[model samples]
Target: MSSGGYKPVVNTVRHSITTVSKRKRSSISEPSNNHEPVVVHRPHTSLAPPGSSRKPSKSSRRRRRVRKERSSSSVDRQWVFSASNFRNLKDKLVLVSYNLLGVDNASNHMDLYYNILPQHLDWSRRKHLICKEISRYNATILCLQEVDRFDDLDSLLKNRGFQGVHKRRTGEASDGCSIFWKEKLFKLLHHEEIEFDRFGMRNNVAQLCVLEMNCEDPESKLCMQSSEQTCTSPRRLVVGNIHVLFNPKRGDIKLGQVRLLLEKAYKLSQEWGNIPVAIAGDLNSTPNSAIYDFVASADLDTRLHDRRQISGQSELDTKRSPFRNQHAVSASQTNEWSQEELQLATGGQATTHVRHQLMLNSAYAGVPGTLRTRDQCGEPLATTCHSRFQGTVDYIWHTKELVPVRVLETLPTDVLRRTGGLPSEKWGSDHLAIACELAFMGEGC
Candidate 1:
């Protein structure tokens, strides 16, 4: 499929997904409403150097709450709220997931961002805006995707007490994923990178890191070593970062990439004494999608779905296209998988289903969504918005060992519409940043 094509338009109303950890599933009507497809064109890449001559003023910083009077100023004042009801918990850990729009990608895909102001597209200004937004969170862990300018980001974050590792994509793609942590908070024990092309999937990549907290207090150490432990063994966590493929037509590859990521997360968790795990990034799949179902349920019968519709992106184009008919045709055809794809995606024979061992849950689960900000699923109404598309594709999923305390708020659709799409003069990326505060179970959570 060409990189340039009409982008599918997602419906506004969506059903919420139940917590997969409880082995529950929620069913909803198949996508029946669709808007006109947005036309997109391929444009030449702009290879501009980083512009960092000027600095932003104090007023340029973001405000915690959104204001009714919107402006073209660099400061972002979007409404922010905790997921569901807010709770004050002790020893809470904050994790943030963001996809920093890559400099090269921004230039190459200018057509999709035509509605955005040109000044907002400048790498220099955007870099400052991105850093300022991140500083406000003061997150202990950050899982970032589409980070092409690692050195610049690292330098900015390093001063804020964060040390990070970056992994570039396997092919010509300039960006990949990065995992950063505050130096005083955690010690990195193990790190690994995943290049999906090696597994015959694609050029996309993922990062896994095992972090152990610093126990500086002598009394805390004694408590951990004592026969009566205060909490779980060793303050440790396993974090996974990934940027799944965006090609909606290649659901086979998407499933395979995610499967490998989960497998790796489980392996690392076991190796590190089955510690708590947090996986964050842009999965490029929507809530309640077949791929999402498999992620939540840890099992999927591939035969039940059409390979192309597995990600649910095709459903967004149902109005103008014959997606329903195509789905039926694809489902009836036999042998949809090649031996390589079958093994990579399902980790077994082409005729079998896919399953994973780790019991995972979305951090946003159990929270209620308002009509303007999220679906009943408690997921953001739209995490990414641009000229061609607007929908929720980013998430932070966690294992049962941790309990969610609060989650960062996502912007309402009306706010995004007012901005004329993202990477605007205010916000730095097309996607909104998601964050969650979590505490280890049985540790005063």
Candidate 2:
């Protein structure tokens, strides 16, 4: 582990990421097996200077690409979309997230070498391309994971009219999380890093930024309801950029990481006057995995025990059912759980002091049925496409206070199938970006 991966506190000044040599490989804490994270990608050997005269022959390049692509028969569909499902888009805030699959200077592991993706050879060009694509959305907020070069990316984003907040993993990994929002559209009120390495792992973290949104229409802002009098309150949102541990073998570690982030999120909402919240990042957990259930579902202690095993089947049912549970977890029910159950339900967990009255849901849940993918994991969306696993691992989750008005589909399945898992000719990384347009459900501007 190198000190190069560690970063400064949440700062307001815009900065660029400084490049380092291949001696630093890091990410959500490791070394003691205190946490588990899904595998990420980076270059195997040091890349040569960009302007070298030598070039591989077309045939040799093709052979290398073919070897890198592996199999694609299983990746028939990319994401679901229906042109006919029209949306009444108005007064909406668009949000997007992506995992760049970047390795810290030397963070990426896998002694068994694989062919390098498009960006592996030239990081500058990759940054330019990825930044260009991300800028096209002009989203209200953008969350990025595995950001090995934080200052560079943050400076790039700031120059594009967005201000960003970033935090590097404290432990082994150099790659961390960075979140940016339109400087003119929102004001950063408070920020901090929620560290989950309390068990001694320094890798996993959720960088929390509380932003007060600027609204043109006073009519659209939320109101403080009171028995005697009422007043208008600034509309705000809690945004988080987090990368979970990657070890698929340890579901418990994933749960612990998520719990730490969400608990902080829940607390921040209260500190920020209980504002609407939206979280985006690479969770590393699949939709059907126990970790997903721990996130998408509320009251995991009771629900999990009732099922007898850690199951994600209910998450699919809720997402598909005509009547999605829009209601928040009732306080009465939350109060019934004992302290022991709250602290050790799934063996040894943290205690979350209940949740906000508003319910949280994945923004993609609002997509019309006809426009969504039908796959084994419930949705036909595949966010991350590494050689070993290719399914959705990136997400944008929000409180019910905000409604999803529209969502952007990932790269077409055909394009993904041809490119194989990632670093395709069309997309920059293995994980495709996800975006959603959300509107305030409480008022009309």
Would you list the C-alpha lDDT of every candidate in the order shown?
A: 0.72, 0.57
What digit string (tens of lDDT, one per residue) describes model 1 on residues 1-445?
A: 0111112223332322211111222232333456322323334333345663444334432321112113322223333333433344335578999998998998998876775657778888988888888888768899999999999999999988899999999989999899999887777999999999998888999999998776553433212344454544557889999999988767788998999999999999999888888889999887758888887889998877766677766344424421121223353546366666668778776455888877877776534335666665667768888766778889888887776766665766766665667887667888889887776765521
Top lDDT model: 1
Residue 49 displacement (Å), model 1: 50
lDDT of 2 by residue, 13-111 (tens): 222222222233323222245433333334444356767655666985676555334322222222222222324434456788988767543235422
Candidate 2 is scored at a TM of: 0.66
TM-score, predicted candidate 1 vs. hidden true structure: 0.76
Candidate 2: residue 321 Cα off by (Å): 34
**Pairs of residues clashing in candidate 1:** none
